[model samples]
Target: MKSILTMLGIAAALLAAWSARAAIYDAIQFGEPGSEKSHGLESDDSEVIRGGLDEPARILLPRAPASWQGGSVKFKLRVNPNRQNYVTLKLWGGDVNENLLILHADGRQVGYRSRGDIGLLDYGSPEPAVPGRFYYVTLPLPMSATYRRERVEFEIVSTGRIWEPGRTFEQYQKKMLTPSRGLYRFYVHDHSYFKPPAEDRQGARPEPVLPPQQPESFEALKERVNRELDRLLGPDGRFTNQMQLLMAAEAAGLEWSRACRNPEAVRRIVAGLDNCYLRWREDPSLASDDRSAVYPAWTGFGPAAEAVRLLHKDLGPYLDEELRGPDGQPVRRRKAWADMLEAGVRHLAASRSRHPKQSMIVDLNLYRNNRGLRLLDPSKGLPPEVVLGCLYESVGLEPWSGPLDGKGKPVLKSGGSDRLFTAKRLPKEFGYDGNDGELPALAAAIYQATRPEPGKPGDERILGVLREMIRARSFFRYPALNLAHNPVMRLETVIGWRDMQFPGDVTYVQRPESGASVLQAAAAVLEPYSTGIVQQMFGERQFFPSLDRQMEDREFRTTFGLLHVPEHYRLLTAQPASSSRLPMSEGQPDFVFSDEESGVLAVKYGSEILYASLYWRAPHAVNFLARIHHVTPVLERLATVRQEVEFQPSGRIFVRPGWTNSGVGAGGLNYPDNVRSIHAGETLPIARLPKTAGTGQENPLAGRGDFYKLLYGPYLFAMNASSREFTFTTPKNIVYKRLPDGGEIAGGTVLKVAPMSTVVLRRAR
Candidate 1:
């Protein structure tokens, strides 16, 4: 009996020892609402889950102490179901930057520096997720001299899947007992001698947020500028490089010239500018080379052009002696400016294609025809319009090779081959489309170079071409086949749909499937011309005011171009008379409104009218046009509006609002399909028509149906809203069809409409 009792005592003692060996240390419960602030864990852009119906809170582990190194380590964790979680463990040596080893929950490990020299022990198996369950993972602790000195950190991340109906209790837990939002709870079980502090066993406080700074006063601003200048120009200044010093000096000179003429500042600026020009000027001998000698083509030509123009205008009289000829003789100030301009032009011109038929500058040697690969076929040489525009702008129209017609207008030579010119004419190769802003940009450059005066010989012709290019390339008209030929056109369509169909949030459009291409298109257009044609066009008041709509859209690239480019604001100072006006008699009406209190402008062509209202106090204004007398009152009520006029063959005129809704819930990723109650007596016009006929069959408006379709034009065009719905009254006995979803409006005096949706009415046979 005594021996049996002693055996039982020994077995109990051995069991107690085994339990102590399995004890967990440094445990963290993630979902406590206060844990985020209580713990020093930092989050990047990802949202913390915090315990919820379907989510678990995420916790980033703090850096481990050096004492925790050199042993086998095990991590026990509990995670919510339906989520794929990843935990990355990084072991650092001395500095955080000096990483020793990186271990992923997937069993992948990478060693860095001296740690790489030693073979890593295999971490058993990859961590697996058992729905709503706990899992354990073991890894041999890195105990090398490099690792013992450095420490470890944990980054826990999770992605959730959509919850489906009828899930098991384990798959979808109805109740969570822990305060920690559904995030994982973790504990470290280390075999090493090191132990964490008792206070740290709970959690650490979150980083504090800083308060915002107040605006600076005028005196404070002046002092700040002075300090910055000193820092840049002082003996121990950061601007020690020659380029930096020169830029600083030129800036100082310009500022002084504007505010108060400081002689010392002016002298320093002129000296710096001269030094820069001498060092950076293109070698005259390299003019024949096709490769761009200027390291960054833009910085070279842009600054040079600005400097020459400024020196000639502001300091020509004061520094005439500084302007020297190639022969080392002092040249006249104006003559020197002209010579510099001529030299720059010559260098650009020298890079042009030597082909007898080509004359436009070929800036991009990799692509033929100056990036207008579709417009100019290498076998057919340069287009006549491009050649004419370049020559007329640079030298004169006399240099053009085309034969003069009856009106003395140069006739385009098609290289003996009859090539069709139509909106649908695109290259067979997918990427060879000519819809890039490059064509319009080149046209604008040529137009500006023409130095257009009211009635110059080639001025009207150049302006006409430019105007056509802008209109044809613009999103004003729908593409013939709905196929986007290029990036700009694609962006136009995306913006149009967002503006018209989905107005409130762009998330639906921004999805990878839909919004990605739109973003790419915006970036492509904005990047190439933000500093060139886009700026110049805006400065010259040549761009349409409707473009301001892009500012309201949340597209990053579009917003960046509009905000980053300085010339976008030039429209504010543009002369109102410069707005394009189209004659109303030709079925085209151009409306211009002039009021100091409200800046409003509208241009109408075919079925569409582009309009914009600019005023901070009353950013919305209604414009009454003489051409559309019937719809003037409706037009006046809307601030920014686009009116579309459709004529049915049945002599019915259908005028409808074309702009997208700017209200909340109209612009997000999710589609808002619920109908809202609209007040009675509101007048609205349906602009889009059905693609199918009354027979419930597809209506192809080509061949047999074309004539009938043309005959059923718009006649009577007034729509009124009922107490809780939209209504349209037919003045004539005509059949009306709704668009998108094909349905006929029963013949009646008043037609009811479904609110918050696009409706197009067509005259049905």
Candidate 2:
């Protein structure tokens, strides 16, 4: 019995030892050394008195044990007169990674800091120190697998000055110099042994949840587009409501007229213009008011003037001969149009007179001329000198001001609008106000008006504006992922006028590259067409090849006009060198040509060629064959060899094949001269082999009926066959008959054709 009792006592002792191992560490209270349960010595500078307002104090802690791994360390601190100060507690130990965690006074986790491969710790939010309040802070000192037990020392510090918003840096420095008393009490406790209040744990709030987005359908997209178009183009359209909207509406109308050549579209165009004119007439203030006297007249006059000019220039031919005026008297369309134009010019002249020292035509004024609309005559209203001065002032050039200095540069003027145009400042200062289409349209209009006039002094300033406008279009920075609207407006304006001027005369400030915006690429390729620019476009399209199709087809149909020409021209890169190609670098022959007979459109840059089929194809669905040339220095070779179809209202159907090396550089169908309508049963071979290609490229026909057909009207039909092996052959059952005046013929025999070729069937008078 004695032996058993001794064994039991031994077991009891072991249990007690284990319990002590799990026991919580003793708490350390700040006071005189040995006054309380102080486990370690205090810093020499720290005062050891019970509790009173005093300076910052520090306390050291006994070495932590290795068995404390996976557990946390915690402490409590109290500050008198809770002031907003940065309260920091730093703990360091022998050869251990430094890890810091911050928490709000309310115990909400905010952030964490780790150093030297130490793991992350949840640092709660840093809350302002409240006077006379105690905060419980928990530090999760995670021990690495390689951690060795060692002594640790921690110090508490609280120091800061009062700060307020809107204080200058100097004031902040001065305020920081003024000190405030910082009194704090520090206490340490074993983290695992103590449990914080439940409310403290619940202080953190989760981030707010967001609702899911509703998916849009094709019909919904179509409906939305229609609604927006109606809102923008209707008789009560918002175009007349504001100057910006008015300009955008005008550009949209112009595009609509070009894309959809239907009666309803033309009528809408005319109606929109009529509304603008009527609105101007109703508001006599727009015509008679002194624009310079208005607060923002400097910005307002240019757009107002541009609106009047476009209304007259674009709407004059389409308007009805006569319309009832406000007094109920019949007014001729031309008379009303001229009246509005005169009023706008008079307003500009008056504004110029009011701001003699200031340039009436600022960069903003030019931006307001989006379509590059020119004055009907520079001789009328504002003279060339005043207009030129304004133009020069807009670009920071005083060509007429004084003779050239030592460097042949115009002498700088101290007081003038010319100071406003700097390379660094101009881009941010000017350009489209927003994604609105007005500014580009306005710029285009100004270019059209001020295009270089030969032998005219000060006309070069117009080119300066043109160059600046291009720079703005290409290089103006935009917010990330944001797009500029109607980027091609200026390009279209320049292309429309290219034929009237010398090829080398017009120069762009920047050469467009592969990474440019889609609209930018469209504009660049057509600007004195280069195969390189077109090839670059093909390369760039890889990034957002379908973005245009998705956004443009659904939301902004205005892009239709901008893309129409580029889409119709198909480039065939598969052909040999003789077919034409464009170089990747600069130095190329700049030429743009449309061969109606061959149905081939081409642009050349040096030895490289960018050519496409002129026949119409669905712009959205066309595909190109991509070939990889190099990987280290990336290069691509894209090719397209497809057939397309177009229909005419006069009972003619055109089928054109893409250009290939086997045929003439360009080839298409030939029509019979002065021939009346063909009989419904008549089949005629329309494609004639060029003398150059001769009979060498001829092949037998498969005579297949597989073809894609489009109907524009009851009489007009178009069909395209994709098979290269198929050929056209006259059917024996159908009869060929001719009719007078090109009347519609019912039956026509299938025409014979070579493999991989196109032909057009038409009844012409």
Candidate 3:
């Protein structure tokens, strides 16, 4: 037999041993990409992967640690063998010819497709009467030896058939015999787990001691990444979400190659990338324009061309470099790819869907997709300089999000507005229109690095705009992601998923592999794309409230947006130039970091954090939503509408009516109310907080953050975001030092807070 690792093209890792447990490991999960488990983890309880037997879905699974005992791989599949469709009798829509699905494990048949009927699907197994679903097609894998040797390939092949959603195996159980053909659909629940050897175990399991990560040489990392990229880009580029991954992988590699000045790596990236593009161009399923594929990404050529240009070299006149242009004549590879990308970006820049709250949903997505393209090569579509200039006029942050105006409307900032949006009154083909909602300051970070500096005499106007936007990020981005993420919001939205109760961890980990985090980490495939980063994102998904939250749950979900684009993961990595770094003062925030525009201030000094949302015009104190308004159905809002960790005027605490009140839940205890209410002018060191009965504040613990799930630093915040004045009384025993003008006060003192301004009181010695 071939070497197991060689066949799978994956290297195995050593892990610590432990006593047997039910789910010791789960290396691959259905439905979810980028959420694989090997040891110490398992896939969340999401629905299932609907890769029909025809288009078999493939996953580059993590190796099972040697310490793990042998276990059985259990699968719950929904099979439909018999189906009929009166809709279309043509070759593409006719009955399925697949009567049997032969599963191959370690290149050997696990199911008897050629022999006995017992191993055949539904041949002898008692299937449900109503084409429902059955649990457990248990395939046992006992770790015969401790060498970590195991089957590297496992496949269930039954793809070539009429896969219509309504049909089932039980409908024609008897006809699952030879030569039968019909429409059919099958589903494998994504939460499949590997059950350990015994239901009865001997003793308690030992604690796993994970080894410290050893850094690999660039050469070794490149080789490893190339192996995975080869599989993803080939055999055929028809696997689910392959286009986005293809684009991101190649673009990121090329970016890294350019940054490192390694033209050799650039060559390697383009070879596979070129082939993948051609394969898709030739594939009937994708090229015919039916567009039914689950993922909606197609811009695989943008980053490759940009890399070549940056490297200052011409892609040699190799005859093998094949690409057909719109005129049916051969053209430069850059021209062809650029042509298609321009079209896609054009449509995206003009998109106006708002019914399903597309603004909140697709806004970040559009920006994310644009990132992989990076908008660098101006050879095709809009001129690079022109595009940046227009984006300058179009993108804006207006109406400083602090207190309300005298007329009760939102106020404008002296510095600039708080939230960002595409500005009004532009000619066609300039400025996008989604809704009057959250735009991007990150765009400034993006353009700043990619474009030239603005302070020069000959510099274009766009550079000045980039400089302006970069500064604006300081004011708003702090509250943009976590403001509305409080206990009440968590119960209904983060946990309950804004009432979208998807099975298992579906809501939390929508597109595990696709997001800003994933894209940015593209260049880091050197260390990340394979290991800790992927799983860590999954772990953090349940709590984070940004685009990194993979919220694309359910089957037929189109990843054609953010998940489908290569992200911007190179934020903290090695810099290409001075522009690569944002100009914000990271080490200090004056004596007290304040932004009049956002009224969202912070003092992140050393390891300590002190944040305040002093004044917010909209009651947008806490929102699980990405935005407050929708464009199409004007004034339509999206929110988890829940109470917060508030400090009411009366100081009494509990669930505040109408998204009111403030409290904190950290380390699984409800301790936020300890701030209590002290009158505005009375500064107290120790606060007289309300008492928790009996067992004391039974609630989930989360360290640091307020109302928003994740813990951020603030000893005890003055938790009022309205235009009105409020006071914060510190808890007993803890004292705070007032900021800007330092003055120590006991924990029970009530610190007065002014509207539309920032205040900080540090924990005193």
- Top model by TM-score, which number? 3
Q: Candidates' lDDT values, in order?
A: 0.27, 0.29, 0.28
**Over 4 Å off in model 2, which ranges?**
1-267, 285-322, 327-332, 346-380, 399-417, 423-765
Superposed Cα deviation of residue 35, candidate 1 (Å) = 42
Distance (Å) between predicted and true CA of 28, model 3? 42
lDDT of 3 by residue, 1-765 (tens): 123321121111100101111222223333333332221122211123232333212221212342111111223222111110000000111112333333333333332221111122222211111111111222211111112432233333331122222234322222222222221222221111212224212121123233233332234323433444444444443333334333333334343322134444345445544443455455523322215333233222333333333332323443236556434677556544444444444444444132112322222233333433433343334334433332333343222232222222223343232223322211111011111121222232234334322212322343343333323332221111112221100101111111111111211111123323333322222222222322333232422333324433322222222322222333323333222211112333434544433323444444233333322111211211111110010111111111123322222222211110121122122112132211112111111222332111321111011221111112333433335665655555766677756688885777666653445665665
Which is superior by TM-score, 1 or 2?
A: 2
Give the 10-residue window scoring lowest on summed lDDT in candidate 2: 623-632
lDDT of 2: 0.29
Off by over 4 Å in 1: 1-269, 280-306, 317-343, 353-435, 438-461, 476-490, 493-765
For 1-765, candidate 1 gives per-residue lDDT tens digits of 323322332333223222223333334545444544444444532234433223344422222232211112223333211111112121110111111112222222311111011111111111111112222222222211112222234433221111212244233212211111122444343321112224322221223222223232223323333454455444454422233333343344333212124444444444544443343334543223313322232122323333333333345445455555445776454334333333433343333332211222232211112212212122222343553444443222223333323222335552212211112211111011122212443444344333322123334564554444343333222211111111011112111111211011111101112111212212222232222323333332323322323434544223222321222223222323233211221233432221111121223333433222121111111111101111110111111111212222222111211111111121112212222111111122121234332221212110010000001122222221112344545434556655323467655557554432223444455
Q: lDDT value for candidate 1?
A: 0.27
Superior candidate under lDDT, 1 versus 2: 2
